[model samples]
Target: MTGEVRRAETDVEREDAFAVRFEVFVEEQGVPEDLEVDGKDDEAVHFVGYAADESSDGSGSDADPRPVAAARLREVGDATGKVERVAVLEERRGDGWGRAIMEELEATAADRGLSTLTMHAQTPVEGFYRSLGYETTSDVFEEAGIPHVEMEKSLD
Candidate 1:
């Protein structure tokens, strides 16, 4: 994928992140609104991925990019950060956008002096996290009605 990811530093950028999460989790995955938009976003660091909207260029010129994926990192204590709200627009999956978001978050975490990173990865995507150096730390459990497993990776 040739897209780019940036840390969300403004309200508008954060809203873009939330919009993608709403589409992927709430609308497509059947996750309830309350669970999808838990109120902890204010304390987290958000990242958004943008892909070029090629189809928007009817005149054959380059089109503006659109936010296609998003995730957040929240410090949960003990110098460990929890990765949360990971989502990529269905049409943009397999384009490496998800990995890009995680990569950015991991770098940010390390820069912030985090000793580790953790996430409750959905069961189906466990392998994805595994490939990124995260190890399953807990047995499968239910979160927001979806099967998940706790995974962690040490930064040190």
Candidate 2:
């Protein structure tokens, strides 16, 4: 997975990032449309992964522009960043795209002076986040009909 992950701050880029999440979570995972399309999008920092054309297997040209992964980072307070809506295309899973996105998100949060990062990870993926230095902070709860747990990590 030697692809580039781009951080998006502009409106168009954010929308494109959200679109990818919608496709994976809402459309494919059966998450309700409204629950997936939250109002926090506008205020969140988005990150996107584009399959590098240079790394294509020759099945398609590198000129094809497709977002294979995305994540959102929102400021929860003066020193906290909330990571949300992290999703990767089904076929792109297990290739490190998700971790890459989170790394970028943490860098962004640190750059913004945030010392702590938090997220509500779906139960099935909690271990994934935990492996990245996050620790569970709360009991599992239901979100959009899915089991999730709150996790946090300090970047200080």
Candidate 3:
């Protein structure tokens, strides 16, 4: 959270975001690559959070910030946007990167005139989303072989 979070504006930035997701979702959690790399990227606004204290990419450059967390926001109509693909490197958890990313996404949504945000959160992390003001709106369900619940937060 001490570093910076920015909307991905280049192919390389997007790739960095995806790399974090692949490490967390596909490699570490056993999610299939196909499911993790869904075709919606092109229509989403991706955000990448960087940490300057350490090198997440193994580049050994402490001075250069490296992507450590990522998430995407895509408008889903009725002035609401869906938050998706949230991921933080295993080493970066508990460092506030997840909250930082969500804050950035919420700020962007507000700037876009969105009145609410939604997400299908994995059950294990439902509490985390709730801490950010999201309320569960659905019973537990399965997605990508994991249990999940739909959650939403009003931006108004």
Alpha carbon lDDT of each predicted model? 0.90, 0.86, 0.92
Per-residue CA lDDT of candidate 1, range 33-129, in tens?
9988788998999999877543233343336567889999999998999999999989889999989999999999999999999999999999999
Using lDDT as the measure, the top candidate is 3
What local lDDT score does residue 88 receive in model 3, on the 0 to 100 scale? 94
- lDDT string for model 3 (54-147, tens) is 6755775666678899999999998999999999999889999999999999999999999999999999999999999999999999998999
C-alpha TM-score for every candidate = 0.93, 0.91, 0.94
Clashes of each: 0, 1, 0
- Could you give the candidate ranking by lDDT, starting with the highest? 3, 1, 2
In Å, residue 32's CA in model 1 sits off its true spot by: 0.7
Pairs that collide, model 3? none
Top of the candidates by TM-score: 3
Rate residue 74 of model 2 by lDDT: 91
RMSD of model 3 against the true structure: 1.4
Q: Which ten residues in a row have the lowest lDDT in candidate 3?
A: 55-64
Clashing pairs in 2: 53-62
lDDT of candidate 2?
0.86
Clashing pairs in 1: none
